[model samples]
Structures are given as structure tokens and as C-alpha cells.
Target: MLPVFRRRPRYSIGSKLTLIIGAVFGLYLLSVTVIGYVMYSQYRGFSTLASSHFDRAMTAAELTRDAETIAAEVFEMLVSSERSINAGNRRAENLASIYQATRQRLDAVDASDVVDDQTRAELDRWQQPFFSSLERLDTRLAAEQSLQAAHLNRIDELFLLLQQLPPVATTASLPAADQRFVGHALAALSYAAAALSAERPGQIARLHGACQQQLQQLAALSLVSKDFIELRKRLNRTLPSIFTSRRPLLQHGRATLATARQTRVLAQKLTSTTFNYHLQLKAAAQQAITVHQRMIRRSLFGLLLASLALITITVGAVVYIRRAIVLRINRLSAAMHAHQQGHDGPIPCEGHDEISLMGSTFAVFVEARRQAEQQLEQANLHLQQMNAELHRLSEIDELTRIANRRRFDQHMASVWRRALREQSPLGLIMADIDFFKRFNDEYGHQAGDECLYRVAQALAGELHREGDMVARYGGEEFILLLPGLSLAQTEKLARRLLRAVRSLQIPNDQAEGHMVTISLGGASVVPTTHDRIESLVSRADQALYAAKSRGRNRFCSAVADDQNVMVGGTT
Candidate 1:
């Protein structure tokens, strides 16, 4: 044999490619890690700064809302105080509790680093006057309430004297002049009483003067009885006290009003200050975001320049290896494209290279894809079935197996809009199973549930119209939406529903007739853009209350020609 040359070591295309790719990848990974570390550090700093600003902003917003709520509650307390003194006291106590809690919150905010020094100083400045004004308001309100009570008691005493005089003046033993004096004194007392009731302090003062003069003339009379002298003495004591109390009551009321005005002004100023501070914090957060975004853009631009250089080096290396790798990859790519276009065939894999391995993987993937497609089709069908079941379950009551409140609400909204468009009458009936709670107590919850189910079914059976819908609104309560029905028609249907449930004869020892019956309230209204569905529901609710009040097992219409009428059921 010709001299056997030593076989040269084989360097495959993959080994050459690995060397070039590993160098390029290592350089790219190093640059990326360094850049990412720098960017992440900056991002973390920006996030912390922005988070602090946002937290402070949120705290300021909460302070503003609390201030507004306090102002509203104060105004409500003032208004309610005019009607009932007990109510006023309760509101005042509640206001005090709310104020104390708000004060604690303010103190916490002031002590915290959430707010800057300037904001903290402003808050401190606002807090002192606001708390002072609130304290003054509380004092004046208490004093006014106390004086009012004393004034009422004194007026009652004066009335008692006036009532005693009426009997004395009618005594026939008195002289005509003394009788005239007693009559004039009675007139002055009456005027004073009227003035007090009407809250005219000036008129009361004038009446007090007239009464005092009359009292002196009566005391000088020779024909005065023991009762007359006693009455004059009581009046003399009572009028001066009443006169004294009235002035102070009036003064306290004025002071309370003035204090309330000052408190409201301070509260509004606090709200404005906090709101502005919140806006400033928000702006600072935005500025931080803007600055961070600029830094990110600059970092990304540097990263992009480095990436382009790496890509240029990668392209030069790839061009050298293109003939070896690109031709085989293109062949595999064409096969994948054909497979995508529904031409499923085996990939022509020949060499033991990376491209050949990809071909084997693609073959396995094709088989997996076929199985996944079948599974996907089954999953889609199952999802559709589940969705339909969920929709049904959502609309049906689990306990009653009737339309639930959610379903009723949706239908009512749609029907309301339709009625508004057509300007037709829409009627609603609110019905309750009478003595259901007591029935639950007598029987058990299971029996109560059965009762509700039967009642819901009975009510639903009574509605023959396609547009009529009966739904279980809540526990033992059902609502019927009867569109296109007038009030008369609604009432008629309500009566039928009442009788239908009574006909069931469900026994309950707690209920009247020893049977379960339902009370129905019906309201009908012609739809208008100005009318709200809530108003219609409220009217029906009122009618339902009327039905219950007139004794259960009856139908009540809210209004028939501006009159409430109830249809009573015979036991």
C-alpha cells in the first residue's frame, strides 16, 4: 500500500459555529448584565422615591375627605337640633367621637414623615383654630339646649297659673272691676304664651310688661279672692323667670350659630390646604417618574448602541458560516411552513447535526399538535357547556328554584327602559309570606325554606302574561314585574295572588287562620323620563307596608286616584 497518511482530525460545522457563537454570546451577556445592574439600581431608587410621595399624597387625600365629612355632619347636627333636643344631643355626642378620632389621625399625620416640614407647619396652624372653634360650638350648643329646657318649664308654670285664673275669674262673688282686671290679666298672659310659642322675644317682653301692670292692678283690688292673690303671686314669680331665660336662650342660639360659621370656615380652609398638598405630592411623584423615564431612555440608548456593534460582529461571523448552516435550516423551515399549511409529512433528516435534531423534534411536535388539537376541540365544547350552565345557575334561585333577585333586577331595568320608550304603564307587586319569621320560630329553618319555595312557585304560577315575571327578592319576599298593566289590573292580580297562596293552606300555628298567607302590595305608573325605577319600587314598598298594617292577607294599592285602598280577604 502506498504509505498510509495519518488521518487529519475532523472539525465539523457545529464545532466551528459553537466557537464563534460562544464568543459573541459571552460578550453580549456580560454587557447586558452590567447595563441591567445599573438600570435596576436606578429603577429601585426611583420606585422608592415615588412610593414615598404617593403614600404622602394618599394620606393628604384621606385627611381632606375626613375634613369634608366632619363639616357635613356638623351642618346636619345643627339642622336636626331644631326638631328634637334628644336627637340633637345624640348627634352632638356622635360628632364629639368623630372629632376625637379625626384629631388622633391628624396628630399621627403631623408626627409622621409623610408630610414635609412646610405642610406640617400649615397643618399645625390650621389645627389650633379649628379645635378651638369646635370646642366653643359644643359649649354654646349645650348652654342653648339647657336654657331652652328651663324656659319651657317656666312657660308651663305660667300656663298653669293662667288656667287657675280662668276658674277664679268666673267666680260670681267678684266685683265687676276685679272681674275686668282678671280678664285683662288673662289676655296679657295669653299674649305672652303666644309670643313664647312663636319665639318672638320682643313681643314676649311687651306682653310681660302688660301682665305685670295687670298683676299690680289686681293686687290693689278689694274684691280679690285667696285664689286670685295666689295666682297673682305665681304669675309675678313666673314672668320674670321666663323673661330672664328667654334672653339668654336667644343669646346662646346666636352664639352657637356664629361659632358654627367660624368652625365651618376653618374646616373648609383645612380641606383646601390638604387638597393642595395632595396635588403637590402628586406632581412631585410625576416629576420623579419623568426623571426616571429619561434615565431609562438614556440607558436604553447606550444598550442599543452596544447591541448594534455586537450584531455587526455576529453578522460577520454568521456570513462565514452561512453556507454550512443556512441551507439546511432553510430546508427544515420549508418543511415546517408546509406542515403549517396542512401538508403533514415526515421531515427529511439525514445528518447528525443540530438541524437534523430540530427535524426530529418537529416530527414529535407534529404528533403532539395533532393530539393537542383534538383535546382543544373537546375543551372548547366543554367550556361552552359550562358557560351555559353557569348562566342558568346565576339566574335561578338555589333555594326556591325561581328567578333570583339578580335576574329580576336585569329584567326590571330592561322593562323600565322599554316602558319609558313606549310611555306605557309598568306595575310591580311586592309580596311577603305572612308570619314567615314566626313560622320559622314555630317550625324549623327547613320548613321555612319549603314555605318560601311553595310561595314563590304559587306566585309565579299566577302570572299568565309573557311579560310578567315573579322573582324571589329575598327571604320570604317575592316581587312581580307586570309590565303593561294598569293599577287596577295590578291590584286585581295581587288579589288573585293573595288568594292563590291562601288556597295552598300551608299551616303555621303562629299565623292567623292557622294557615300561611301572603300579603301583596301593587303599584303602577306610566313611565316618563323624569320618573325613576326606584320611586316605583318605593311606592310598591309603601303599599306593602300598608297591606301589612291593615292586617295581613290583603292586597293594597299605593294610590287609586290619589287615594289608598286596601282589598281585604275573608278568613
Candidate 2:
């Protein structure tokens, strides 16, 4: 792969910085552009949806209202027909005229399609029964009037209750109180003219005049309010008196009947129109709400998608840059340190990517740095040696000369690696003075130092070959490295050292029984193969723990074949 996009050197640092800034800016712009596209798409969809639904809802509302209005007007006419007929003032002809006008109004409501069959039936029931009752009352009155010219006493107080008969029992029934009943009554009245023509000619002419006057007055009655109660009462009494006086004297019984029917019809019409209008408005409002919610949801979804895409791109960019630059820099930095220490080979090259190219360039820089480090290393070596000597001088107790921590780490790595490569059996022993800290307080730091030195000497004396090495591991601890030794031999040497140290009888005031005892942990491994350094150390450490657990003044050996663990000593 190519390392990186190359830019001309003629572009100054400022120019390069500007270009990088532009690239970052362009990424932001692209995000904004995508978001804008989403928002714009949502806006268009919402606008289109709103426009279509709004007009439809409004039109339906208007049509529903118009149909209900016409139904109300027709209902009024039907009620008036009853009034004219009962008063004995040519009521049938009057009905026939108003009925025609009411029919024209009802035809408009039918065209609007808001009224159903049930509504039509209700209207017919209210108007038909009422108008029929008027005709029946007229017939009864004419017969009674002709008989009264022969006999006068039949017209009595019993005639007053004729109006009190239930409307349902009449020739045609009256409407219910609600608005739907009013619409039904209106539809019924629209066809009343044909029914009225069945009345006699002299009565029909008088009925035509009565129907015209009643229509004018009933239409005006449609505007009745509580505030007009007095005016309504006066008109009610006056109109009935004038119309009733013209009737055959025996027809007086029908007065209240006609008035009641007209009232019921008016009430039904007002209720039906108001209720239908209300339903239409509610439907329109619901449609608007549904459309609004859809628009909001679409916009929110667009925003969510855009936000997710932006986050994904941002995370991807961050990961790519980190792997490309940060990880490579860290690897290169580690390799450079090892080379400077004269401890490792050159860095590896895996690709021609920017990180790889940078690594290659850094390798050259490190080589030059290494030459410089060589001169520095020589000076550092001399200084390090002096520092080590100084540390040994201060820390080494006069009685026991062994490697301190300052010197131990400096030598352990080299010796351990060499032993591993040679495949020689290597043995390690860790010896600790039981209760050394208490012993030191009981005695003194000098006495404690002396006691430690003597113990170290005892361990050194047990060693028989040049391959065996002894060192003071800590204030009251010592380590012995024995090469070419098996597990049995290493244990024997450790036991001997423990015996020698015990014989010294160093004062350990903290001891409960035998004082100044020691514990030894040993490991013997053939170093012919390169095993892990940590694993070897861990095995030896485990052995030391076994010895300590068994009690002080003992030695533990790790069996290398099956890695058998044993703590062996005379307790």
C-alpha cells in the first residue's frame, strides 16, 4: 500500500495546516448536507399530506352542516301544518303550500348525503301523523258542526281534553325531542302537499292562506330565545285566538293538540341540525391531529437516521486514525528503546502504509541515535559500576559479602539466560532467618548484621564447585545458585546449610522453641532447553512456600520430572 498522500514541499506548514483544516471542515459540511436532505424530505412529505387532508376535511364539514340546516327548515314547515289544520282555518291547503316549499329545502339536504334512511323514517313519522291528525280533527269538527245545527249540547267541556290525547294515537305520530327527530320531521313535511289536496275545495282555498301565514310565523319561531318569552307568550295566545275563532265551534277540542305537535317538531329540528354540525367539526379536528402526528414522526425519524450515520462515521474515523498513527508510534518507540539498551534487533516492517513508512524512517533515526547512545552508554557503564560499588559498600554487612538487590537484578538475567541455553541442571535455594526482624530488635542492627553474615558464610561453605554461587538476598535472606545439580543434591546442600546456620545459635528472641532457625526452597532444572524464565522462577517460589508452611529450618525441592513438590528437613 502507498504510505500516504504526498504534498509538495512548496506548500508551507501554514498551507498544510489550512488544507487539513479544510478536510475536517468538509467532513462537517457533508454531515450537515445529509441532515438537511433528510429534513427537507420530511418537510415536503408533511406539506403534501397536510394539504390533501385539510381540503377534504373542510369540504365534508361544509356539506354536513348544509344538509342539517335544510333538514331543520323543513321540520319547521311540518310543525306549522299541524297548527293551521287544528284551528279550522283551511289547514289542509295551507299544509299543501308550505309542504311544497319545505320539499325544496329538504331536497338540498338529500343532495348533501348526510341524512340516512332512519332519519328519513323519523321525519315521515313526525309530520305524516301530525298532518293526518289535523285532517281527522277537521272531519270530526265538520260532522259535529252539522250535527250542532241540529243539536247544540254535544259541544261541552269533554271537547277540551281532545288535545290531551297522546300524539302517538293520532292519525300520524309526532317526532321525538332530539335533533335526528327534527330531520325526520322535515323530510316528512316535504311531501305533505299531495296529502292535503284530498281536502274539499272551499276548505282547500282557506287552507292555502292558512298554510302561507303559518309558514311565515313558524320560520320566525325558529329564532325563539328565553329572552323573548313574553313576546312568544303574546304571539302564542293571539295567533291561536285569531285562527281558532274562524273554526267550526265543535273543532275547539283540537286546539291544544295542534299547538303541541308544532312545538315538538320545532324542537326536533333544532337538536338534529346542531348535533350533526358538532359531529362534523369533531371529525375534522381528528383528521388534523392525525396528519400533524405523522409529520412529526417523519421528521424525527429522519433526524435519528442522520444522527446514527454521523456517529458511525465519527467512530470509524477515530479508530482508523488511532490504528494508523498511535499504535505504530508506540511500537516504534519500544523497539528504539531496546536497541538503545543493546538488547534487541531491528524493528519489523509489515506494510508501506504511513505507519510502516514512519517506522522505517524512525529505524534510521534510531540507528543514528544508537551511535550517539553508544558514547553515552560507555560513560553510563563507568558510572553504573561506580554506583554499584558504592551500593555494595554501604549495604553489605561486614560479615557476609553477597549481591544486594542493586547488584542481583544486574546479574540474574544474564546468568539465567546462559543456564537455559547450556541445558545444564540449575539449582536455586532461598534461605530466610526465622524471626529475623524480632531478633534484630532484641539484639541490635550490628548484631543482626553479624548474624546474617555468619549464616551466609555457612551457606557458602556448603558449596563445592565454581558453578555454585551464594548471595545475600535481603536483610535476613540468602540465595544460592548451584549449577549441574539434581533435585537430591540440591536438597542435600540446602539441608547442610540449614544445619550450619542452626549450629550458630544466633539469638532470635521471638522464637517459641528452637531459636535462629532457617528455611530453604530449592529448584533444580536442566537448562539445556530455553524454558520461560517466569515459569522457572515460579516453580522455585512455590517450593519456598512449601518449606515455610512445613516450618522453618527445612528445605523444599521441586521434582522436575513430574514437578513433584516436597518439603524435606528435620523439624
Candidate 3:
């Protein structure tokens, strides 16, 4: 049986980052995102609930005011015969306007946003009776006005009949004294007509007594002339109807007044309920605020734990990967350098992790066959090729054709240290494509990649200065470094980059404005001992997140109004 040697699996840089750093960071990010989303949803719910409660309160108040005004109008109509016709019509117009306005406001209010279905149903239950009462009140007022018109017109007709009725006598001739008495009675009726027309209830009541006195005097003529008997009989016939017409007016008045009272009562009840609902929502809002605050504290605790875990995982992964790849590569380089100098030392080919390390060991085996002189030259060539491969892998993003995450990490660290040593500000910008994941889904991965390539080129081209650098940080995110730049300069550059990408007019159906756009978060800082390079990156990240939150296609700074942090916009 032949002995078998199992080849060890060598993990690539990307795979290692994924298994350890990526996994930890992804968990932290997901947790933070979920917590933020929950908080935002809670805030939205609170705000909407508060707004609905306020709107309902205002509407209730308006309804109450309208109901009161309508009731006042009903009261005014009771004295309608006393006021000018235009005045009465104006009141009617006002009542209608208020009622319509209140109804519109009520109709626009949707209580379902804050309250439960059961509460909404209860509100609907209350609304029906209240509005129905208002409608009934409106109807009763119309009936009352009609009855008033009928009553007044009946009095006018009776007065007219009194004036037209001719004297009745056996000789077909009436005495002047009888005629004078009839003329006096007709004059008193004319006065009653004048009072009724003026709508002066007090004058109408006073004229009632005068008109009665005149009728009494005319009654005396019954004994004097046969015409007086017919006039008196005809007058008697109308007096009953004129008196009876008051019954309908009184009935309609009572109905209207009763309905107005009912409307007012219902309106008051509805208003009280609205106030109670507002109070309830206010109390609930307070409770929600407390709950939100607790959640914020709890989320903060969770974040701290996640951050610690992320740091631990990151440090461990960095140590292991650096030791595995970098240590072996360094040792191989030393070996090659030693062989070239004709100084042969111990070249320990210990690890299975590095294929390059394995290849170096194989080259040593052929040293005797090819002769050490020739092998040294070949080893130098191979080492140079290996270094070039490692540099390429370390710096370039495979997909975006730009500087990768490794370059960003290395560059940011270097710049931060340089800033710390020189005491100059370092500007960092973190940018994200708005709705990029949706864009990717709509356009397909091929188009998305092409879009990224184009966007990266545009972004890279924007950095004309030698001190400026652009790198593909991650999915749909890019980072730029501008060393020795102030916040204003960084903000200006960020907006310029934003415009540059947006100017491409890359068709992104999923994004707002129906085109591809980028949101940038910018931060410039003079390094301090207390903070790490990640602090500046975190600032930029937060600003980027803020830009996205504000509807995207803009720029934001970590410090909202701090003199050291300037924000810009567009695109």
C-alpha cells in the first residue's frame, strides 16, 4: 500500500474575512438595523397617533362651535318675523357654511391610524347619532320657518278680506255712520298688517288688542245694519283659522327648539368624547415615550455587547490571517534574499497554508540539479512574481475594478497616523447608492456590476488631487480619503462626487427621480489619542446613513452644525 499525503486547504483572504470579521460585523449591522427600524416605526406610530388625536380634538371643537351656531340660528328664526328678510337669509347661509365645513373636516379625519378597530367602531357609533341629530335639527328649522310664513300670511289674508267685503242692507244702501265705523275698523286692521310686516312681535301683540277693540266696535253695527251682520259673520269665519294657525307655528317651534337642544347635547357629548380620546392618546404617547427610551437604552446595551464581540472577532481574525499569510511570505522573501547574497541559512518550509511557501520548498529540491547559481536567479524571479500577485490581491477589488476594502482599511489607518503625527485634518467620505439593492434586482447583476464600474470610474475621476483616494468599501458603498483637507473642502468634494455619478444618468428604475444617485456622509478630523481610525469611519458611516434617511441623493455631516463639520447637498 502506498502512503497517502493529504494536502491542506488554504483559505483565501476574502473567505477568511467572511468567516470571522464579516460574520461578526454582519451580525452587529443586522442587529443595529433591526433596532433602528423598530425605533423608527415606534416614533412614526407615536407621531401619527398624536396627529390624529389633535385633528379629532380640533374637529370636535369645530363641530361643537357649528352646533352652537346652528342652535343660535334656530333661536334667531324664532324672532325671524321681527328681523329683515336679508338678515334671516344671511343666518341660513352661515349655518350651511359652518355645517358643510364641519362635515368636511370630520370626513377627512381617519381615526384608524392611532386607535384600534374596536375604538374606531365606537367612534363611528358616536358619529352617527351626532350627525343625525344635526340633520334632524336642520330639517326642523326649515319646517318652523315654513309654519311661521303660513301663520303671518294667513293674518294678511284675513285683513284683506275685511277690506274687500261690502256692506249688506235691505235697502242696498248703508248709512255714513255705519260706513265710518267700518272704515275705523279697517284702519285698525291695516295697523295690525303694518306691525306683522315689520316682524315686530311686541308691536304685533299690541296691535292684537287694538284690532280686537276695533272688532268690538264693529260688533255694535250688527244691530244697526244687515250688512254689518254679514261682515261680522265673514270676519268671524277667518278669526278661527287665524287663531288656529298659531297651533302649527307653536308645534313647529317646539319641535325645532327640541331638535336644536338635542343637537347641542349630542355635539357636547361628542366633543367630550373627543377630548377624552385626546387625553387617552396623550397618556399613551407618554407611555410610548417611556417605552421608547427604555428600548433605546436596551438597544444601546445590545450594541455595546455586539461591538465588543465584533472587536474580539476582528482582532483574532487579523492576528491569525496576518500570521498565516504575511509571516510565511516574509520568511520566504528573507530566504530568497539570503540565497541571492550567497548566504545560505535555514529556510524552514513549515506551513501548508501558503502555496508560495510550498513552491519555495520545491525550488530548494532542484538546487542541486540546476546548480545553486541558476536556482537563485529563478527563485528571485518567482519571488518577484509572488510579491506582484499578493500586491494585486491586497489592493484591487475584483468586481468594481477599483481599490478594495483592504486598500481602504490600510489607507485610512495610514492617513489617520499621518494626521496624528502632523496634526492636520483628514477627511473621510462614505457614500452609498440609493436603493441600490432594488436597482440590482431590477437591472440584473450584470447591469448592476456595469453600473458600479461606471460609478466607480466617475468617482475616481473626481479625485484629481494626488492626496485623494477612492476605494470600494463594500456592497453599494464607497469610501474616499482626502488628507489635509478641512470639513468645507471635504463637503464640497462630496457634493461634486455626488453630481458626477448622478450626471451619468444611469437608468435605475428603482431609485427616486428614476435615475441612479448617491448619498454621501462626510467627516474631517484632526486625529486625537482617545479615538481610533474607526471613529472617523464611524462618523462618515453615520452621516451616510443620515443622508439616506433624509430621502437620499444628498450629503450630510456627522456633526450637524459643528464648525468643524460642514454638510452639502444635491443630486
Candidate 4:
């Protein structure tokens, strides 16, 4: 021999499978740990970037809105009239408060780490000028408001003097010429008052000239009253002061306009700065997304590689298992299935593996089970025949061979439900031998049983409809279920049944006509959820009593009333 080499030790399928599965599980665990770590890191980074930038951007937007609103309010103050000045000032104070709150919010945002030093500096630079412009605008607005108030006061004084002159013109003590001069003065005063109200400078000046001419003419009249002279002196003092107050109100309006322009420019600059800051945030967010995308792609690439390796390993293991073990197991399974279905083919039992041992054991088990199954099937067949006979005997009376009380109850329930669903009439008949107890007493129990069987057969044979059924309710009593039969139809069928029983002519010495007969009490009703099946049975029993009370061998029908069953009619 050149060189004798020892054979490699053999391993069982379980050991080899465990080793392959363990290796696969280890690789899977390593891949999952690496992927999970990379994904978690990327998620944390993205979450931080998104939250910080989104919050800062929202704060910047709020600041921009407040700034524009403040600028609009300033312009509104400048153009407002004296009547609205106080209201505008109140609104201005509220806007200033809002602007301050917005600034505080911006400051809070700037304090966060999201804001860079350059952005904070730029924002601070814009905020200072914006605050100063708002302050200057507020000051000019206050000055304009004060001038308006003073001008209104002077106008009020002029109106007071004009009112006093009206009473003087109405005085009867004055001469006619003096009265005419007083009227002319009152007319000029009215014109002046209108001019002041209109806020027209030229109209006020023209009215002042007309008033001066009227007062000078009245002074030339020596007959003027002492009161008139005093009133004229007061008018002369108040009118010129009203004219002077108008100039300052105009100057304040011009100053307020200049301040509004400066405030608007500052607000624009602040808006621009906030917009730029927002753009920066958007760019930073985009950059973060790009970087995270790259990370995600790398993670996905690693996952794909891991998945491919797992797939390759799994496939190789599956091919090995299929060839080594699964094919044999499948053939054994198929053979077992075929044996169960009555084929006696052999099971696959090859190799020294566990499956081969299992297959050999299974072949013996299959034969034993098949023999047992055949014996069990014969026993099942005999048991099924006995069950069918028991079921039949349970529902049918032994002597009469018709349905018994149990079957009657089940049929009543089934028929009632059908009638209720279809909204159809269900007719029930409670039929008895005309004198059943007397008949049984006169004859023996054997003859009584024979009579009951004959009567049951007669009733069942008389029912023509497939849905109709007759059952022996108890000793010497039978019930009929006629679905879709009205009271009239039920009575007609009951009469036919009575005749059919009498035609049998089974002798009963105690019965009517010395022959067998039946008295039928029948009731028909449209079934309703509110009504009970027992109610129908009771109504039929009542009608049966009525038929027997009237005469033997008759059929009586009953209808339902609000409180009780009323005997409808008899046939």
C-alpha cells in the first residue's frame, strides 16, 4: 500500500444541521447589529437637525409677521383724524407690546445652539434700528395727537362766542338797523363755524373777513346794546386763536409722515434679514438630508449584501436538505397519503439516516392503521344505521307512526318563523276523537291504540300541501300545522279531515253515530314577532272546545281578538 488514509468521521444529520444553522444565525445576528447601529445614528442626527431648524424657522416667520404689522399700524396712525387719534394710540400701544413679545421670542431662539454667531449678529443689528424707528414714530404720533386736542379746544371756544351772538340778534330792544347788523354778524359767525368744522383754511379766512365787516358796522351804530358790545369783544378775542392752532396740527402731520417712512424702511430691512435667516435654515436642512441620504444608502448597501449572503446560504442549505432528507420524507408522506386513500404502495426507506428509520417504522404503522381503520369504518357504518333509527323513533310515535310531540314542537317553531318572515297566515288545528276517553274506556287499550294509528294516518293523508304536517301531540290528541292557510281554508281542510275519519267507520260504541269521528278546532293568524306560538295553540284548543260543545263531528274556526280568541264560525 502506498499510504493508508483514515476515513473522516461521520456526522449525523442533526449535528450537521445544527452547525449550519448556528453559523447562519451568527451571521444574521452580526448583520442586524451593524445595520441597527448605523440606522440609529442616522436617525438621531436627522431628528436633531429637523427639530432645531423647523423651530427656528417658525420663530423667524413669527417675527417677520409682527414687524410688518407694526409698520402698518404706524402708517394708520399718521393718516388718522383727530376723532380716531385716541383709538389709534391705544392700538399702537398694543402693537408695541406684541412687537416686544415677538422680539423676546426671537431672542429665545437666538440663545439656542441652532443660531450661529453671524446670524445672531445680523439680527441684532437689524433689530436696533427697527426698535428706534418705532419709538420715533410713536413720539411723532403723540405730538400730532396733542396738537389735534389743542386745535379742537380753540374751535370749541369760537363756537361758544358764536352761540351768544345768536341770542343778541333775536333781542327786540335793538333798533331795526341794529337788528339787521346783528343778523349779518350771526350769518358770518355761522359761516365761520362751518369752515372750522370743514377744516378749510380759505373758507375760514373768508368767513373771518365777513365777520369783521359786520362787527365794524355794528360798532358804528351808536344804539348797540352793552351786552352786544361785550359779546363782540369776546368774539374778536376767540376767532384769531382758532386760526392759529390749525398751523401746528399741519406741521405735526408732516413730521409723523417722515417718521412713518423711516419705520417702514426699518421693518423692510428686518423682514429681509429674517428671510435670509430662513433661507440659511433651509440650506442647512437640505445639507443634513443629503448627508443622511448618503448614510442611508451605505446602510442599505450593507443590508443588501447581508441579505444576498443569507439568501445564498439558505438556498445552499435548502438544496442540501432537499437532496439529503426532504425528498425521502416527501416520498414517505406521499406514500402515507396514498395508503390512507387505499393504495398499498411501499414507503421510501433508504440510507442509514433518521428519515430512513422513520420511513421503515411508518410503513409498519401504516399497515396497522389501515387494518384498524377498516374495522373502525365498519363499526361507524353500523353505528350510523343505529343513529338514523334512533333519530326516526325519537320524533315519531311508536303506535301511530306519525310525528310525536317533540317533532310537533320543532315543526311549530320552524313554521312560525317562516310565516313571520313571509308575513303569511299559519293555521293550527287541535283535533281530537269526539269522545276519546269514552272510546278508550269502551274498547281495550289495544283497540284504542289501533284507533289512534288509523286517525293519525287519516289526518296525514288528508294534508295535500308539502308544507303541511300533522303530529300526535299527546295521548288521543293531534295537532295540524298548515302554513299559508287562512281561517277559511283551514276550516275547509278541517271539515275534509272530519269526513275522512268518519268514512273509516271504525266502530266506537260510545262515539257519535256509533262510529269514529273527529272534532277540529282550528285558528289562522298572520304570525308577528309580538305574538307567541303558544297563543296560536291556545286559540286552536279553544276552537276545538267550541266545536265539541256545539256538536260532535264538526269543525270550528277561531280568530284572535285584543284579549282572547273568539270562535269565528263552525262548519
Whole-structure CA lDDT of model 2:
0.57
TM-score-best of 1 and 4: 4
Q: Each candidate: RMSD to true structure?
A: 56.4, 27.9, 45.7, 30.7
lDDT: worst 10-residue window of model 3: 81-90
Considering lDDT, where higher is better, how would the candidates rank from best to worst?
A: 1, 4, 3, 2
Report the number of the highest-TM-score candidate: 4
TM-scores for the candidates? 0.41, 0.30, 0.34, 0.49
Model 3 over residues 107-214: C-alpha lDDT tens digits?
A: 577444554565445555665686677667656666666776776677777667765656444224656766766676566556545553443346556666666777
Q: Which stretches of candidate 2 lie above 4 Å from their native place?
A: 1-399, 528-530, 561-564
Name the lDDT value of residue 40 in candidate 4: 91
Candidate 4 residue-wise lDDT, 1-571, digit = tens: 1122223336667987898888889988988898889879887977876566556666677776766676676666656555236665556567667767876876775555655778767877987887777777777777777777776777777667666664663557767766775676676566556556544557667766776676677567665467777866776676556555665565567667777778777777777776777677667667767887888898888889988998899889889889887887788889878887878897777676677767767766776787788889999998999998899899998999999999989988998999999999999999888777887888888889999999999999998888899999888889999999998888778778877898888998886578988878888899888999998898888888877787767877776562323333322
Model 2: worst 10 consecutive residues (lDDT sum): 153-162
Supply candidate 3's per-residue lDDT for 33: 87
Which whole-number lDDT from 0 to 100 does residue 443 have in model 4?
88
TM-score of 1: 0.41
State in Å the error of residue 504, model 1.
Answer: 99
In terms of TM-score, how similar is model 2 to the real structure?
0.30
How much is 506 displaced in model 3, in angstroms?
Answer: 1.2
The whole-model lDDT of each prediction reads: 0.76, 0.57, 0.70, 0.76
